[model samples]
Target: MKPVTFRNRTWDVAANLHLPADFDPAQTYAALVCVHPGSSCKGQTAGIYAERLAAEGFVAIAFDASFQGESGGEPRYVEDPATRVEDVRCAVDYLMTLPYVDEARIGVLGVCAGGGYAVNAAMTEHRIRAVGTVVAANIGRLYRSYGAAAMLDNIGKQRTAEARGATPLITTWIPDSVEDRKAAGVEDVDLVEAVDYYRTPRGRNPCAPNRLRFTSLANVLAFDAFHLVEDLLVQPIQIVTGDVPGAFGSMQEGRDLYDRVKGEKDLFVIPGATHYDLYDRPEPVARAVGRLATFYRKHL
Candidate 1:
């Protein structure tokens, strides 16, 4: 994997480019942009999949979204859906600059909320030939689950305060620790597994600090990542999610996306895998990668 940087509007996006062991500069290869989960970074699950996909003979890139991780942006940790979708398009622009990349064979894969952003971007970004998602979560729907009206009111106050010179309000994606979660009476299986994967040594990375600007909720609440997907998402898509139900609702969201898309699509449900299991578990991830390799090979 080679560390690289590219321009995404005014920010510099950091990424890791993974290439096959026998990669030859003289040969053009199909490439994939691997988008990391929300509150996550390129060095985590996205990086893992990019590396594995490279081993499958595809050039893959895992990148840090602008305003998060090593990427450059102000008021750091903001999770605006519009910018997230645009980041995917910018990644494609960067890939097209490579002489060894086949611009016509580029595809995209996203995990967790990144999956939602990828789908949203691919709807209008025809440069992407195929779409793949793993444990996809629609951020807008997830936020609405917590009651959008009240959250929007709070966000309004927070934004007003920040505008008047108050420091940006910060919130964590999950509790600081398992003990904190238990103390808060949070027992959701998806949240529990998320803590295990993101806050622990199993998948933690300093770049993915797991914090978000509280005021960023306004955009997230108003944005629908899957809006107009039925009409605009014409690319072949492969949706992967665990069968186990959880508070995050990604399993249902995956089904919703699969049923709504009118184009060629396939749904793969890992029997016992939970939302976070497919993030890094060896067996589940391997199975997902194998399936994705086949899909991309056929489409891209």
Candidate 2:
């Protein structure tokens, strides 16, 4: 994996492009840009996906989102839905410059919140020929009182506070250190698991940043992840989700997105798996990525 700096049409984007040991410059290979979930760096599940893809002969990338991880952006963790989605477009622009890449066969795969960002990018960017997601979150639905609706009110207050010109409050996301985890116990798979995986050693990496800005909560609310889901998607799409009890919500969202597709599409529900399980577990993720690569090879 060689490091490169990409941009979001603004600041420099930090990324890792993994080339297989047998990579042949004379041959054009399919490429994939694997986007990390919110608050996570490229080194998490996305990196796992990238490594697997590279092993399978595809040039793969794992990149940090603009405001999170190692990427440079203002007010660290000031993540916005629009900006995050556009970042994918910027990644595609960067991918086009790679000598061994097949620009026409570029695709994207994202996990959790990263899934939303990838879908948004594929909806708007024709350069991305195929799209795939795991533990896909419809950020908008979750924002607009999806499940665990109570949290929205607290988030709304944070938004209002930011709007009133208050100092951008910095909030802690994952446990800052091992001490923090000892103080608090791991609970559900949503926010806690997010903080746990991206912030702790279980999924933490060297490139990720530790601070999260509160204002990003407000910005994420405005992001309708499925905004263009219905009419704008013109490429191959595959949505994979776990079939655990609470995870059914994502399955429903996947179904909703699938029904609106106007092109080649697929949906897979891995039974008895939970949301976080898809993040890095070999079995479920392999199935999803295999389906994704196959879909792209057939379509693009």
TM-score of each: 0.98, 0.87
Q: What tens-digit string does per-residue lDDT give for candidate 2 at 190-278?
A: 55555666666787776666667865666666677878677898888888888763522576677777788878888888887777778
Could you tell me the lDDT of residue 155 within candidate 1? 88
At residue 97, give the lDDT of candidate 2: 92
lDDT of 1 by residue, 186-205 (tens): 88899998888888888989
Reference-based lDDT, each prediction: 0.93, 0.78
The segments of candidate 2 whose C-alpha lies over 4 angstroms from its true place after superposition are: 146-167, 174-192
The residue pairs in collision within model 1 are none
Per-model root-mean-square deviation over C-alphas: 0.8, 3.2
